[model samples]
Target: MVDASGRQARGEPQGELAGRLRALQELSGLGVRALARDTGLSSSSLSRYLNGQTVPPWPAVVALCRVVRRDPRPLRPLWERASNPLPAPPKSSRQGRPLPRNDLPRDVPDFTGRAEQLAAVFAAVESHRVVSVDGMAGVGKTCLAVHAAHRLAADFPDGQLYVDLHGFTEGRPPLDADSALRALLAALDVPSERVPQDGLEQLAACWRAELARRRVVVVLDNAADAEQVRPLLPGAGPSVALVTSRNRLLGLDEVPPVSLDVLSPEESAELLVRASGDPGGPEGRLARDPESAAEVLRRCGHLPLALRLAGARLRHRPGWTVGVLVERLAAGASEFDTAFAMSVRQLGRPQARLFRLLGLLPGASFDEYVVAALADLPVRDVRAMLEELLDAHLVQQPTADRYRLHDLVHQHARRASAEQDPAAERERALGRVLDYYVHAAAAADAAMPFLSPGAPPTAGRPPAELPPFADKNAAFAWLTAEYGNLMAAFETAAAVGADTHVYELPRFLRAYFARRCGTTHLNVLFERSLAAAERLGDPVRLAEAHSDLGFARYNAGRLAEAAAGYEAAGLRVAQAGDARVAAELALRRGYLSWDAGGVEEPLDLFRLAGKLYEEAGCPAGAAHAAAAEAWATLQLGHREEAARRPGRCWTSRTPTPPGRPR
Candidate 1:
């Protein structure tokens, strides 16, 4: 009996088939020759079968089964497997082939999460000849690919080959397809002289031919794009190739692509704990403060590379708490900056400039129009540049028409902007964004009548072209989507001494804040507006600012502060000669006084405000003051006076309801 290679099998028949055959022979209580006689087969053939050196023909096995009184069914499957062993590589192919190289980087010891991703990759390689893992820089695409490749190494016995293509490396051009193929050829043990010194197609053909019958795993890391990776893929066979890149590599649609995102919060903490070297030490301490640990992870953007760097930093600095590291990262001093820079450096000058300007944007995300406004570029150009940035993985579109920078990438872009862009240019870009936001908010406010019925008018000229919105719903949606950014723009305006914008932006937002019933951000926006108004020292604006601040404070239930704010605004109201506003301020102060148990004082203040409002031609304000006086009169236990005051003073309109003051 012979093996698949046509050589005589040596040694005892091995594995399950050998054991079963030997058992049957023993059960027959016969030596090879005796078994052969009993089974009607030649002695040498029986000997070979019994030794697992060959598979006997079915009739011969049936004769043996009868002699041994054993079943042939169960043994037949084992017999088949033993008979058809996996084929060996041709002698010539194996003679000078390079030794198998286990070139994969060490798997991350504290690698956390990604079970689903790993399974997807494994499943993909089973059917697809090639798979690519892609994601933003520092998102751990290479790490994941390497780990999965190592798990699958045993299936491809010819070798595991790896090459770094330098796709996003700083100060270096990406490895071209021809050069990558040569490296792969050399790894496969094709002699240096034999590798074709020709075009990429010829070299790729030779590489594919070499892998035609072999089962090998090739990993091409940091690929710049599909073009750089195309020649490195092996031809159809048992071989598989895994490619990792920051770019999406959409050009390789034939190859299944798995995109990696940042780690989840829980997995991120686990990684930090495990990578910290002493989970029971500082990491353990951090575990007790999950909020702080979560903050650390958030500041790190839950990115594995950032987490690893932070974990290592914490591991080495036993004296430092996780909060310390969090503060550092929050201040934008992160190891991830270098990794992010590599991706940025790959961008074209226009795209890089857009990326830098995007970092200056106050919100977490923005639409193309906002970007256009900031960059002073046409909307179409902004959209195209954004697409370029998206393809490079420096920016991500979390949803349709909305692009956001990863926290870490945002930090890097900010740093790059500070370093590369001049101070004046940064300020100018920021000014443009603030101006755009102010005008856009005003337009939205104007379109939504329910929100701005009695809202204060903005002081600036209208923008030449308002941002397009289909209707009130679209306007409200835009406001809601950009609420945080609007707040940031308000604060930034104050910081940069854009005093007119500072005071004007909040006026447009005030109605939105009131309509949404947003107290927290309202307080912040008005406070910043007050500061800006104070800097300008315009008493009319000051009165408006103080009135807005008092309103926010009053809603927040800080009655004493609200009263003081109203009182301060009253002093400015007379200077500004707005008696109607003065009446409003007096009415607000009276409410605070009534809430604080000063019934008599509040009644007197309300009466005085009512007289001033009537004189200033604000009958609604006069009636509101009258209603407040009636309420104060009732609170003072004078039911008759309260009833009489309501009849005589509230003739035209009812008072603004309590807690509904705006």
Candidate 2:
């Protein structure tokens, strides 16, 4: 309610506070999306806050106030009251609630023959509230799990959630338990501020608490092992979980295991008939060519993935008889090979070449841009070819616009590429891929400038084009999504003795690691990059590697080792005479000194850092160094001098002293 003064009445604090926030946003003259972009918030969440549906977090309120140049301290009491409002009625008493979330992938229309396994899955979920479906690759573990989830969707009306743990994927590491839990919680529409940023147990507890209130079915697909999936299970509720893995999760003793095998010969034949849309009974192609049909089935090993691919080939080429398919399979050395070979042979040369080169891709899954880089083709051309490959069943689109090879298909592509493409050509293609990642990562890093903004030197040919990142969030999203592939690229570079790439690539990941990942992996990457830098015999690069290693060590709390790395960097950087690197080294050394309890030395080093940064023409670095110096002065009991400093210091950003990189 508003008074004659057009101000909120004394009561209704939530409404008053929301009105103030809305007024602040109006003052800023930005639309909802623009304000959200400026405030680092999702528009949906911001909308809720402005409409009084939810209390904005303190930081969010502060961000909003900052955008409008208003003092937020005046609003603290009202915010606190709004945030601590009376508890609402229980879920049982709530009315007109939203429908449950459903993220399950579409069920295969021709999902054939897993009757006994499907029954076992339902029974296990009923009894144990969890089921682990384990089998060999391409035996339809994921298919059966997804199918079962779709079938049980009505029973678990709370929601259906799905997550791929990326276990047994060719190049990507399995998703860790913490990340998996966060994904689960996010799918439940939990606010980002509510999710714990650290601690596996805390995240798991939060997930359990949320699940306890509702009946949801979660599919933890492509899990690496029991340990990875253990924390993702619901504790006590109508909610249940289904896990699928290539290896049997023997460690999940409480969860019943349903092991799948290749389809039986009869089932396989039926699947082929269904997949190929062949007429049933004595007049069908299989009935006319029994011997060849058996050969096709044998070649497929009755594996669902292989069978589907083989069946697709036959379906697409109606003129070809079973005997002709068998003749194509004869060229392959193995049963599995025959199935894949037949499908691959149907592709046009460019599509076929792209298929073969996809085997050389280092990541488990990739988007079209990366594929374009790998195949040295236009993205439009790659998209068309990918469609062709998709139809051939040579590639699997696990998600929209992202593709991967079935393990069997991956092996076949590798073999075929090796036999056909020359070694030099393969290396060149991989080099192009590495170059694309380096430039892309550099571009992303540029969007989100870290303490040291020096670009890493690219060693391979740059791609014809690169992906665009519009803002820090866009850059961060790209980094998070491509982290696994970037790691794989680094490893591939090291394997091929691409020392320059090995040394340069990890430099781009420092900011990402500090945010999403911790220092352990960062330390490992810098360690490897340091070795690469040494191999390349470039003093400036070596200094950068050492400085980066020191930063990682410092973040990981290895102060002594960090000092050693800084010392090494200092020596090498002096010899190279790069002003930017020298500035970085000085700033890092200042941080090291401050961290090690040296008062005067740190202040001196900070001053030197400030001077070098000015020389390097980096105002951000200079300001950071100046702030460090001011903070150190305050530590030395020179409060007046520290207060007189021109720039504001962000000492509260870190728990420790003023030693963190800018």
Model 2 Cα displacement at 521 (Å)?
1.2
Model 2 TM-score on a 0 to 1 scale? 0.76
Q: What TM-score do all the candidates reach, one by one?
A: 0.43, 0.76
Clashing pairs in 1: 13-51, 13-52, 98-189
**Residue-level lDDT tens digits of model 2 in 1-662:** 34312323545668788898999999999999999999988999999888877667556787898898886767865876675555668877576666788878778778988889999998999899999999988889888999999999999898999887888766456777866786678678775656765578988998999999988999999898889988999998789999999898989889999999999988999898988878879998888999999988888789888788777878899899989888887887876788888887787888889999999988777889898899888888899889888888787786786787776788788888999999999988999999888888888888885554675556787787677899999998888778768888988888889998899898887777766664566788899999999999989899989999998888777788988998899899989998888888888887667545456787788888888989988888888888878866754445677777755454432211343672
lDDT for predicted candidate 1 compared with the true structure: 0.72
lDDT of candidate model 2 versus the reference: 0.82
lDDT of 1 by residue, 152-194 (tens): 8999989888777867753235666765675577567676545
Reference-based lDDT, each prediction? 0.72, 0.82
| Ten-residue stretch with the least lDDT total in model 2 | 650-659
